[model samples]
Target: MAVTLQSLETKGLPPVNDWHPDFCGDIDMRICSDGHWEYMGSPIGRESMVRLFSTVLRHDDDGHFYLVTPVEKVRIRVDDAPFIAVSVEQISHQHVFTTNVGDKVILNPQHPLRLSDEGAGVPYILVRDRLEARIHRNVYYELVNRAELRMLDGQEQLCITSGDHYYSLGMILEQD
Candidate 1:
């Protein structure tokens, strides 16, 4: 299938609760003027955005977030030593809230997470210094960018970083 100016212009997921249509069970990618990639139709921008806006599967009943990273080397900078950070855990489903990660707890749909840079060199998502998102498989997982993504907002901002690029996330931003 082809993602045209029309489809690209159609913001947001099509009223369907689940995007998996009968014809295309699971479209893992999108193709547009940008180019070809895993998360095809996603916007592009920022180093942090790349880590936040990848493939958003579904905010499952498990009470955590899930997604797949199409890119690699999620960078983690620290006070003592900053270096390219690779995911310790497999890039599958994971939690976004835990002790080692501040022991902070913010439930989705209940609270709007507050993001803060604690100098942990860890990854995070936020609205404005508030940690609003996390990783969740057995727990709340941090959301990271797998591929480049578009915000799907009117502007359709790019939310990924490859040397010198940025973007916005296309996944669902939990309703509060």
Candidate 2:
């Protein structure tokens, strides 16, 4: 899962990778406050805040904005007078046991919920009512939208640019 571009380089790929995608969920949308809305390689912070009487907005971390760690905090924006959450003690994990497939309690049938064995069959998330945050002054697309898994026969690495930034994404592998 931690594979890098080097993994593909050694495999000997070619030039000008042609791409065709078949899904909408493949995009990771980022709506930057600086009038830039782009799609990137990772998840865009699902929360966006608009500046009052202005176009600029700011990014509030899911509290896990750091480059190396992963955490999920759902607050949309930092308070005008920022305050860090302090708990009396270790935060208690709220147990959610609506999974009928996993023996437990709290079953609500109005919302779609299902889980199945993963290793032995297809694994996927259930489609349900969801909210997508789109807070940007404008619209843009990022390299995540340019992904192409070209067949290994004869293809190339990817070098696409957005604004003044240039990103070179190397070849992707194909398995038959």
Candidate 3:
């Protein structure tokens, strides 16, 4: 399917959530763990193109990522999550995150944050419709600075609150 910049300009992001397309086989595209988008073994350098492609990205129940358009769906490899949380801000007691693709997600029950056991428990937040953005190291540090010690299940944990929900950053490891 052809997705033109002019079409995107007129309609904003495509209704990918509503459009279900058939898989068109895998493409030589990958979202690297370090938050770089690559196509055909080279980096996709244009931010506009990346942002445009990101709008049509989707995660299917088959445990794969795909770029979906109304007429076609093509799989892509993702080393980690599809997007990276580049920065975060606390606005009106809400933890707001900005992804590399320019998507802003408010951390709440609908867009909750979770810690991955991989590599010192990296944090990730849901951007939209089950698509998550791995929290950048510096942004994770900012969250740690804002976290407070809280008791959960009889264990001391560092947690950040967004609205009425408390999400754990991680458990405190006691000194040996």
| Model 2 lDDT tens row, 17-53 | 1222221222233333232333353333323421120
Better of 1 and 2 by TM-score: 1
- Top TM-score prediction, candidate number: 3
TM-score of each model, paired residue for residue: 0.20, 0.18, 0.90
Candidate 3: tens digits of C-alpha lDDT, residues 30-90: 9999989999999999999999999999998988999999999999999999999999987
Error of 3 at 98 (Å): 0.4
Which candidate number would show the highest lDDT if scored against the true structure? 3
- The segments of candidate 1 whose C-alpha lies over 4 angstroms from its true place after superposition are 1-95, 99-107, 111-144, 158-176
Q: Model 2 lDDT vs. the true structure?
A: 0.23
**RMSD of each candidate relative to the true structure:** 19.7, 23.1, 6.3
Candidate 2 residues lying further than 4 Å off, grouped into runs, are 1-57, 60-156, 162-165
